[model samples]
Target: MAFENPSREKIKELLQQSDTVAVVGLSDNPLRTSHSVSQAMQQKGYRIIPVNPNATEILGEKSYPSLRDIPEPIDIVNVFRRSEFTPAIAEEAVAVKAKALWFQLGVYNEEAAAIAARAGLQVIMDRCIKVEDSILIPSGKTKK
Candidate 1:
């Protein structure tokens, strides 16, 4: 069975209010999907904090090896890992009391979504932050 994400209204609210988003699995390579999406959010004015054990920095923000290491309050936890890894990440997101957990396209995790939901964290799975940001990009700034 499929899991449901927050409604459109909830997503709009979350995006409007989220300021600091921790991007788990963000890669140093700009060519990677995670890097590109994080850049999109950056352009939208959301601070992107990279969380990769191998990365010292990404998108100019200091990178942490784990969610628990991030000292600042995290509004959103965007994951770019495989489905098998999402449950653990979801647990960490819940533990940190994050406002939401987002799993990028191709990384859907029903169980993980349920876990996040149970923890009272908004969950979005199998979606791209970049595409969502594109819709938000104002007319002049966004290309057709």
Candidate 2:
């Protein structure tokens, strides 16, 4: 069976309910798409955890080398890496017990989606999290 992402309403609800997003491949450079998108999400009140091995910190949050290293619960695992790398990330997300796995625009992998889905993770592929939040949750605040 082909992989399908969650519905718009489901995604909206996920975005509303989620509090922490662990950004895999987040960059310290402001010019990068990962950095800009993560910054916007941070401004939207969600706690952004950077998961870049190279950077010690990004967007004022401490950076972890991998998902397994994050000490706190991760509501979402947002990935900015290539499609080929996502399957491993999905495995890590599942291992970390993240609620959702999101692949940024231009990043999509059927294997990764299947892995996360099988583990009961809400999988979103080839979509921009920042755009989704701006459109779905225009208020930029998670519902309490």
Candidate 3:
């Protein structure tokens, strides 16, 4: 079956409730989409955790080599890697008990989404978290 993104309302709820996002494949370069998007989200009050093996720091936060390396609780696992690489990340996200698994635009995997969903995690694919935040969350209040 094809992968579908969660509803806008659900997205808004996730964004509003999520405080910390672990950005996988985040880059140190400002030109990268992950860097810019993560920065924008950080400005909006969501803590951004950079998960990049090659970078020690990004957007003023300490970067970990992988998702499992992060010691703090992660509300969202936002992935910037290609679709082919997301399943492993999804597995790790499930193992880490992330609340949601988000695949950036152009990165979509049905199997990964299924794995996370079965594990009780909300799944978002082929979407940009920053864009969704602006559209779905206007008041910054999460629905209870």
lDDT of each model, Cα atoms only? Answer: 0.86, 0.96, 0.91
Error of model 2, residue 70, in angstroms:
0.3
Which one is best on TM-score? 2
- Model 1 clash pairs are none
Report the lDDT tens digits of candidate 2 across residue range 57-129.
8999999999999999999999999999999999999999999999999999999999999999999999999
Instruction: Put the candidates in lDDT order, highest first.
Output: 2, 3, 1
Candidate 3: clashing pairs of residues:
none
Q: Is candidate 1 or candidate 3 better by TM-score?
A: 3
Per-residue lDDT, model 2, residue 62, is: 93
The sequence of per-residue lDDT tens digits that candidate 3 reaches over residues 17-86 is 8999999999999998999999988887888999999999999999999999999999999999999998
Residues 1-144 of candidate 1 have per-residue lDDT tens digits of: 578777767777777778889999999998998988898788777889999999888888999999999998999999999999999999999999999999999999888998899999999888887776566544313221
Candidate 2, 117: how far from true, in Å? 0.6
CA RMSD per model (angstroms): 3.6, 0.9, 2.0
Alpha-carbon shift of residue 40 in model 3 (angstroms): 0.3
Off by over 4 Å in 3: 139-144
Task: Count clashing residue pairs per candidate.
Answer: 0, 0, 0
TM-scores, all models, native as reference: 0.91, 0.98, 0.94
**Which candidate model has the greater lDDT, 1 or 3?**
3
Name the lDDT value of residue 21 in candidate 3.
98
